[model samples]
Target: MKAENPKASAEVVWANNNTDDASLRLWREQSRQLLLSEAKARGLQSTSPCLCGSGDRLRDCCLRPLR
Candidate 1:
């Protein structure tokens, strides 16, 4: 099962009702952009190991662009 968002459910609900696929896609893109910006802010390199300790490089894992 996918992990639930660490953010509040109500917050997500208010952002863009998860019931809609388009809304979900938009939300995910927004989240991804934010994450990339944050990584850049911290000087995290694309080739660095993932912070998740998944034994994969960032570009090959979390830092990869969304599908």
Candidate 2:
């Protein structure tokens, strides 16, 4: 499913097409926030693995977006 933000798709494509860590990080942070929000809405615990499937705890992942 596509994200609600139209620009997100373009940004993802651009980030994938280019080897830019800044852009990629920005996209990743946005994705993390979205995933976290969705998971919270669905009553998922923060101690659970991130909804993004990174295998890290949701609280840890979202709290430290730079990682």
Candidate 3:
């Protein structure tokens, strides 16, 4: 799905599934935080294209409602 739509985040892809598993939710949150931390460490700016390959600014894409 991501390959088909670069703009789709993992959350977006899994949104329809709606799992109640605590472990899975924790893992997803941790992974998201890790990715964001790594991006910050790499000096990614809000105006930079997202590493997710969404072709959208980081702030507009994965960084939405965060940074």
For residues 2-63, what per-residue lDDT tens digits would candidate 1 score against the true structure?
23655423444324443587766676688678767876887877777766577787678865
Q: How close is candidate 3 to the true structure, as a TM-score?
A: 0.50
Candidate 3, residues 1-67, lDDT tens digits: the string is 3434666454443444565567556766776787688788999877888987879998788666332
Most accurate candidate by TM-score: 1
Cα lDDT computed for each candidate against the true fold: 0.64, 0.68, 0.69
lDDT of 1 at 58: 69
Ranking by TM-score: 1, 3, 2
Q: Model 2, stretches more than 4 Å misplaced?
A: 1-17, 49-66
Clash pairs (backbone) in predicted model 1: none
Clashes of 3: 0
lDDT of residue 61 for candidate 2 = 72
Candidate 1: residue 24 Cα off by (Å): 1.6
